[model samples]
Target: MKSIKSAGVIGAGVIGSGWIARLILNGIDVCVFDPSKDAPKSVEKVINNAERAYKNLLRSPLPKKGVLSFLDTVSEVAKSSEIIIEAVPERLSAKQSVYKEIELNASNELIITSSTSGILPSDLQSEMKNPERLTVAHPFNPVYLLPLVEVVGGSKTSQKVIDETCSIFSNIGMFPLYIKKEIPAFIADRLLESVWREALWLVNDDIATTEEIDDAIRYGFGLRWAQMGLFETYRLAGGEAGMRHFISQFGPCLEWPWTHLMDVPEFTEELVDKVSNQSDDQSGKHSIDELMQKRDDNLVDFLKVLKENRWGAGNTLKEFDDSLGNSRIDFSELDVSKPLKTFSTHIPKDWADYNGHMTEARYLDCFSEATTELMAIIGADEEYIANIGSYFTVETHIRHLDEVLIGEGIYSKTQVIYGENKKLHLFHWLHHNDGRLLATAEHMLIHVDLKTRGASMPGDSVIEKMERIYSAHKNLPKPEGLSRAVGDKV
Candidate 1:
């Protein structure tokens, strides 16, 4: 996939700011134009949240941060960018004006995209001189974290543009779902609209409060939906009999009045007040900032869990991780002559102790993460564990060299002290961003067959790579605390 190095964003509201955040984090420079005075703060807020969530959710090192600029006009943003993202207000006239400016200022090579939630791309491209370059790249809110993007093309949109958009998005750690048939609201939003209609009716009729409806989802089917979509999950209900049999038994329910989805309740002022009051009652205590933090934290944790299990959205995250491995320094392909800097991330607030410095357990976590990456570098990944064998840490020594304050960035450099047959020895130095040594850990690992759980020889691939690393690292002075135990001086 050809990477998009520079992008232009036309607005900086919730969706526009999200696009800017996602783009810049992937190391793409962005120029944005939004007339509102709050645009800068909005983008900054989203970027901060995105950085926090990404540092927490992803273990791999991120690419170098990109440059961001705020421009006075759409023409300025369009002329400077390889791709133009129109995230203006959803109104047709507002969007059309932006497109006209883009056509006048941008080169024909530019790829122009819209972030409209439901507006058809055909309508958006109708007044464009380069309609073929224009497509709807609808993304969900908090776009930095969510991977799904719906790439829909209008009648004049070339397949080349659609393919290019998907490739660019995928390269930047997004799943660009090429929506073949353009329709109102696209796919996922349509599904959401059904539930939304039903929920609104439920609230209007006083059958359920806003909080209760949310509870029904988050507590019940929401978990299932995360890993398996609606149909696949329902397919499980069929059991050994299969979906056909399950449908035979329960499909008739669709004919029944189980849903108010077919009709939307009157959107009256009273109904709005009812929902507003109930929603406020449910979560008015938390500021929007607080709610956004909670949302990002919860989503990141859930993604991490899913990543561990390699399911659903988690699978997408893992693939994205694979793509972004060593974004700052490619670990698998690094020079073995030096200590390998395999991991880097900020010390999130949750990792801190009461005194506001990084706590002890997280030290082990950071070391283990670096070790795991080293293991993968030598052919001991999850697939290897499932099929062949893996290295199990048998012993560890950690020295606290200095304090890592909350929000401080830290990184690790690894040394292979010994690698032969069944045993492997590792030394990791955790360094603060400013070059201070924060901590050090030495680990002893034994390769074990998964079936027997006994010490065993790893594959030649693993042994060979480890030997190479060990050979290169043997000449370097031993790590300061190479074999030091607890309470021992360095």
Candidate 2:
């Protein structure tokens, strides 16, 4: 899978933000555009989500970091991007209009994928100038964490487009399922719509409350669906007779009136109110955001279990770990110091070693985590690093000055020694829960080009931010570690 040098996202809605998170987490450089007044808010929400994803990935292993940027127009992003993901609203005319503008600005080689639901690729391509270049790549919500993406091609879509789309999805750690023929709602959504119709009918007839229906699925079928999909479930249902026998018995339901697809629900005031009241009762007192968070939490827990077993999409974790390997960095002594800012991280039980002290590796991990926070304070937060491709970790020299037992938190004081060009030198002093200096680690970081894997100059904006901090510390006493530089200070 080739790395996406630059990608463009054409919307900033929830799904758009989700696409942004997925691209950014996978080490791609993405530029996003949306015409709404709340575009910035949308980007911020995605960044927060990306941060949460980053934390989760680190809980297991470090994930590839991607750069993210926002543009004012579709044409602006299209002009420079290698790939374009159209996530504008689901309206055909809106998507077609955006496509026309993108075609005018983008290169012929740029692959364009849409996140449209139930929109046939053939119909969507009919509206485009170069129809062969576009395909529909629909992804589920919370796209950064989830692995499934349905890749569907149109009549005019070239084989090359399909192959390239598959490659791009894989690069971003997604499971791309290609549909050989176009079908409305594709595969998964069609099945979901069938079930949804039945659910509405059940509520309309008051046979079961909305929550009961949901419970039936979540506590029953949903559990099975998580590991084995529909066909496999039905195979088991056949009791060793297999799908043919299972179909023979269930096929008679085709003539039943139990399903309500033929008639649209009246959606009358009474029906709407009934469904609404039942939904509210089913959800209890949880707010919409609360429900979303709950769903995310559950998915995270489930994915972690899969990750531990290396099952299903969780196998992607092994790929992620393979990419991480046994990388380590060490930087022993450096120059002088500024007043140290106190930073603390609680030592989790997992960090405890067989000897009952914090594991040496975890000491390094916590110190690295501290470095991330320091980078954030120095203006190297998610968005900035996303754009500039410059991160601070170079080398660290960690000394186990004292033992840290379980249930204890360690604090660190970071003092900047000096910084020049694209490098920063900092000193760290680790302390125990009661505030005694435990160890010290010196860090020498050279800003890097994430795409090229080489040292590069820090962005001017980032350097300016760093200079301001340096100026503020000019009058403060130099840190103890910098005692040698006291007489020869710059």
Top TM-score model: 1
The ten-residue window of minimal lDDT in model 1 covers 325-334
Best by lDDT: 1
Candidate 1 regions exceeding 4 Å error are 326-338, 347-365, 368-396, 403-407, 415-426, 443-478, 483-490
Give me the displacement of residue 184 in model 2, in angstroms: 1.5
Local error of candidate 2 at residue 215 (angstroms): 0.9
Alpha-carbon RMSD, candidate 1: 3.6
TM-score computed on alpha carbons, candidate 2: 0.67
Q: Enumerate clash totals for all models, in the order shown.
A: 0, 2
lDDT of each residue in 1-490, candidate 1, tens digit only? 7897899999999999999999999999999999999889989999999998988877666788899999999999989999998888889999999999999988998999999989999999999998999999999988999999999999999999999999999888888999999899999999999999999998998899999999999999998998899989888999988899889999998899888776888889999999999999999999999999999999988888899998888888998887777443344666999998867878766788899998899999999989988998887888899999889999998888798887788999999999999999999999999998888999999999989989999999888888999899999998776777687754
lDDT of each: 0.90, 0.75
lDDT of 1: 0.90
